[model samples]
Target: MAQPTAAESWSGGNEPMKAEYGKLMMWFFLVSDALTFTGFLTAYGFMRFGHEATWPIAEDVFTHFPGIEGDQPLLYVAFMTFVLIMSSVTMVIAVNAGHQLKKTAVAWWMIATIVGGFIFVGSQAWEWYHFIIGDKGGIELADGRVLKVAEAQTGEVLSLSQLVDGEAGHASNHLEKFSTGEVKTAFEANEGLVLQSPGKGHAQLTRTESLRLMQNAQVVQGANMKHNEYGQGQFANFFFFITGFHGFHVFSGVIFNIIIFYNVLLGTYERRKSYLMVEKVGLYWHFVDLVWVFVFTFFYLV
Candidate 1:
């Protein structure tokens, strides 16, 4: 056995290992991860493709804003989209700081990333709550026409003409007195909606109860014909599953960022003299951001 010369031991001196070790490993990991994500995305596409007709139009389904009325289209989700993109920008900055060996800067930028993650998660929770507890209840009729239950105490869900004509039925005279502002905000149309239980231990309505409501023809699904209360079944299913999956990712990202923050404070990277740990974490954070970009496009944009 003989000791190799310095030059022979050097990577460039012998048969090249192809790419630099760190970069090669990163690329390999990225390729595998890309495939994993592709599996999820492809699955989503297959499900959506088969049920296109039964999927709600994204804009019509999610356009709930204060002071908006009658199914007017809105772009609030575009704002959220921008916020998530900007968070990606901040994460990139943190990655660059690690390259420059700026530990304090890395700590601060990592904290910002966590804050952005928190904001995004909070927004998602708000969206979920709004969707689950929408003001109107949806009833699927035997003939398949949906009946919408409004906040009106009067049992009658009357048309504007019927209300003025005094022909609205028993629950019709309750006079909820919702102004345009209130109605627009309180009664978001087409979102996945569930009826609130009357009180504790009250049995929640099943499909049977919902069908019964529709059988009586008590209420038109929407007075203004703005939107049917029953969102396309496929849309509601995808909406919950996709957003819930992304939220889980965001939660995990926050936890990961916290660990990195502690590492930064303790000067671990400085002792190691390489910020590869930060780079690795950055890759993970960017992957999260990338997943959200697709989610926004599929769930909110299209």
Candidate 2:
């Protein structure tokens, strides 16, 4: 019996795909993941708009970089976004190299993508630390309203320790929790720190108003499942859950890329004379990057 000709094989099978099982499976996974993210984001949108009065501002919540500081809002997150997008570009280059069987170029491009993933993942970790530990510590009132001290002259937000005389540690360290009486005393003694009130503007508190508002205040550190320096607890919950979920995906992609990079180093694809695996992985890498664009817009830019 004679085998089918090359032309016949190329033109047949479900129209084109001869054995693109991996690509098909990857698409299925991406579609399912998209649905999950859509549901979560929808819930977030509803909760956010429902309680618009108490929702935290994205810019203020995620404003930290590393050594360099001073209220450089959204700078670090923007860099993370850029790194992730560049990684997707490198993935495209890697897939192209794989198609051409340029083993060296493929390996190098994969390495670049891996490095970008690391930077993104690490940036996410730092963000989590800052968020969980909080920056400007606030005082929670009886009605669940959180109020932070701001400079009356410069409008600079001050942590509770600054206004309240507590044996506080560094912003990154465990805070020395202050009582309501202490906070009230501090505010009464120092006429510098003002109050941050919503709706009336971020800095719309008189010296006397600030002193009166601290009548029933309790110290609150950064943010957690229960409390947040920003606003409502839901804000912190959603931030942690949504961003943490995306971070896990990026981490998984890093591991997958590492496995493929290891295979590239060992000449596995070269021996097989096919770069199909690299192309499949590239599809996943691009999908991850695409999802992040939406997340960034929804959470940060919006």
Candidate 3:
């Protein structure tokens, strides 16, 4: 048989899975990002389980709620998760509206999704603030163990400032200014306070032993790369790395949504006789929401 001409033999590349080029690229990006998140969560799981005896309890660590008098474990985190999930719902509606070529409906739904995104991002910021500032402070011993002050009888954790004479401001970094002598003085004056290690089965030390441990201890308030008032430093490190990374992705998605929303308002898709752009962005928004569900499970529920 005679060889076919090059032009006759040529055919456009296949559109695998019947996806448009842009949608396919987005899926590839999401898969890569998902792997990155999986690696991070896996590392966190190893560290937490390896030091199961000393790992901080999620409920105890995330007990703060805005404008609340006392600890409310995981309540605020649940709120954030709900908002993100609802945003995904709005994105679905927006995509459906685009499929029907209803420009006004698409615009309104896009706005709703954008609002939900803003709420979630703002809530995450509030959570980060509390995590970095800490609630009750602790003492880091020479061997890197952290011990919190609590009522000897009730075991209710107390802030270092509560034992001290003056009002301590809410500044997250203020505890760094307190001298060891000042901390020792506060500990001595509070007769009912004892040092307790954080963990599932950790024991509290007697007053005498706590005082002795204080002699070689450094005060730690809030969390940083080097010190954590909660428990092991690795917990804080992982918290910051994983959550901050996810937050960045959410922020980027919000910006992308905003651009799509503006285009929808301008009838750009209607003029093109296709709403493929809205569908593409919807895929991303849904992916972001799905990832948050896993994050919520790993960080809060697990």
Screening candidate 3 with a backbone cut-off below 3 angstroms (N, C-alpha, C), the clashing residue pairs are none
- Model 3, position 79, has a per-residue lDDT of 89
Residue 24, candidate 1: alpha-carbon lDDT: 62
Relative to the unseen true structure, what is the C-alpha lDDT of residue 30 in candidate 2, on a scale of 0 to 100? 93
Cα RMSD for predicted model 2: 4.5
lDDT of 3: 0.85
- Candidate 1 local lDDT, residue 114: 87
Task: Provide TM-scores for the models.
Answer: 0.63, 0.85, 0.89
lDDT of 1 by residue, 1-302 (tens): 36668876874445355444665676677678667667766776787677554444566445554354433343556655666777777888988998899998998988888888888888787666646544333443445444333223333232322323324432232233333332223333413232222212222344345434433432323222233443444445566767777788778878888898899899998888777777776777777778878877766665
lDDT of all predictions = 0.58, 0.81, 0.85
lDDT of 1: 0.58
Measured with C-alpha atoms, the lDDT of residue 193 in candidate 1 is: 30
Evaluated at residue 264, the lDDT of candidate 1 is 88
Across residues 1-302, which tens digit of lDDT does each residue of candidate 3 receive?
46556675576544437788898999999899889999999999999889876688888888766776566898989989999989999999999989899999999999999999999999989888888877667789988988787888988767777666445344432343556678888888878889887877657899999988888999888888889988988999999999898898899999999999999888899999888999988988888898889989997888
List the candidates ranked by lDDT, beginning with the highest.
3, 2, 1
Off by over 4 Å in 1: 1-37, 65-74, 135-137, 143-229
